[model samples]
Target: MKADFLLIGQGLAGTILSYRLFRAGYTVHLIDDAHPSASSRVAAGLYNPVTGRKMIKTWMADILFAEIEPFYQEMEGFLNQKLLHPQGIFRPFISFEEQNEWLAKSADDQFEGFIKEVFTGPQFPGVNDGMGGLLLKKAGYVDIPVLLQAYRTWAKSQGLMTEAVFSRNQLKRGKDGDWEYQDLTAGGLIFTNGIRAKDQGFFDWLPFAPVKGEILTLRQDFYSSKIINRGVFRIDLGNGLGKVGATYDNRNIDLEPTAAARQEILDKLRQLIPEKVLEILHHQVGVRPATPDRRPILGKHPSEENVYLFGGLGAKGVSLAPYFSRKMVDFLHSGEEPQKEVNINRFFKYI
Candidate 1:
């Protein structure tokens, strides 16, 4: 058997990259055991242009946001599912100082496109926006699990996916610089295996700071079309269903959803709104593949010519994966180099 690429892991990174490669007329065989708690499987899939405590525009927001909606919409059409939610984000002001700062930023030319409204008075009712908030455009959440499952079903039907664990022992380099794994021989291999890569031998030299996060799904009377983001993001999932998340813990390197995290989110939610939680429908935990500098890991392995790595998307996986996947696919399909920030070659000296 032969393929243009043999991809490891069917997480969001692998799924998107495989789809992109397939669309570009390349054969891609994916191997994944389908872990029950993979990060992509549990992600809320929020894509916001503005982020962080300082509340500034995300890096390359213009480029990343431009590719996001169209890319997810294309997948939605292909999968025949409504996975992309186009609701804008509403971030409440924490202090009068912050409100004043945003009022000034709203008039800035840089934020003109993404800024929907700068509320000097109030934005939403039945909420704790006494000082008002900034309504941002071109931001929303993707139903990641739905999209991943749809893609998995489609890939299985096409016989392009194998459900199994992938290890270095199964790989052998051919004389022509291709890779051979079991019955198939492929040109190259790419690893997008999330936190599992931390223990993988080939990538141990690369710095991976795995951060655990927890989120909750609640059934409440608070039904709003817009996503409210303050300390924690509150996304309305329709039909009195809402989602609030996520606590980032870099120190606690475990997947258990702690009671502390739950309390933290609850406290933050109360601070945002005075709504009563009807029921705690679900609680989930997943570890994000983060890095020291919080940039993505892309490009081929430094020593191995045919092996590649793509991850370190952290909390922004939903917003970053699609755009970077296209860039990585182009790099592999041709000799195009990824941007200096995300390219894996930046850490060559440390390795």
Candidate 2:
């Protein structure tokens, strides 16, 4: 089989890039074994313009937010599924001082697009927001598993995807300076395999600080329209169900859902809201492919021709993938250079 590009992994990074390349009229093939612990499958898929304990705008929020909704809506139309939920996010202020600060920030022209409302009092039932909170626009979660599954089904029907473990040993350089893997030959090969990239020969020197995160689904009586995000996040899934989560632990890189993580999440959940948990529906864990600098790594390999990487999205993959994947497609199709910060050339010194 011949293709313009052969991509490794079908997680968020790989799936988004492959779809973009396909849309650009390129023949692309993917090799993905469907790793159970892949971060995309386990992620809550939240995209908030304002995040963290400091309640500041996320990195590249303007550019990233601009593309997020439209890109997901396009994918939804293609797949005939409802994937993007633009329900917005509500972050409660920790103190009166923080509330006053945000009230002042709401008037700043810089925050015009993202700020939805600055509530001075509690807005919902069964909640604990006494000192007001910041309501943000252009914020929501993506149903990542549904998106990946639908895209995989479509890709399979088109003969663009193969389900198998990718072994580097079987990959060889063809006489024509292309990549040859099994019977497949491609002009270029891209590694979008998430944390596995650290061990994937060509880009090991690039610093990858993997962090493990765990999320829990619970059956609860309390509900809210907006995503309640403070210490942790609570997403109302309707029908008396809600999803709360995400404990970050960089030391423990394994996929196991620990009791400690569960307790930590519940503790944080308590701080965010006063909702009672009726039942614990599920608990899941995934190790995110984070970088020390918290920026995505993109572009071609320094020594190997036509080899590239598109990983290091970390916890923000839902927001970062679409925009950066478009950037990557442009780089691959038109020979355009990606920005220096995200371009792989920045790390050539380590290589």
Give the candidate number with the greatest lDDT. Answer: 2
Consecutive 10-residue window with the lowest summed lDDT within model 1: 194-203
- lDDT digits (tens) for residues 154-247 of candidate 2: 9999999999999999999999899999999999999999879767698889888899999999987887899998788999999988889889
Worst 10 residues of 2 by lDDT: 269-278
| TM per candidate | 0.97, 0.98
Model 1 earns a TM-score of 0.97
lDDT of 1 by residue, 106-207 (tens): 899989789999887776876788888899999999999998899999999998988898877878998898999998889988888876775667788888
**Full-model lDDT for every candidate:** 0.89, 0.90
Each candidate's clash count: 0, 0
TM-score of 2: 0.98
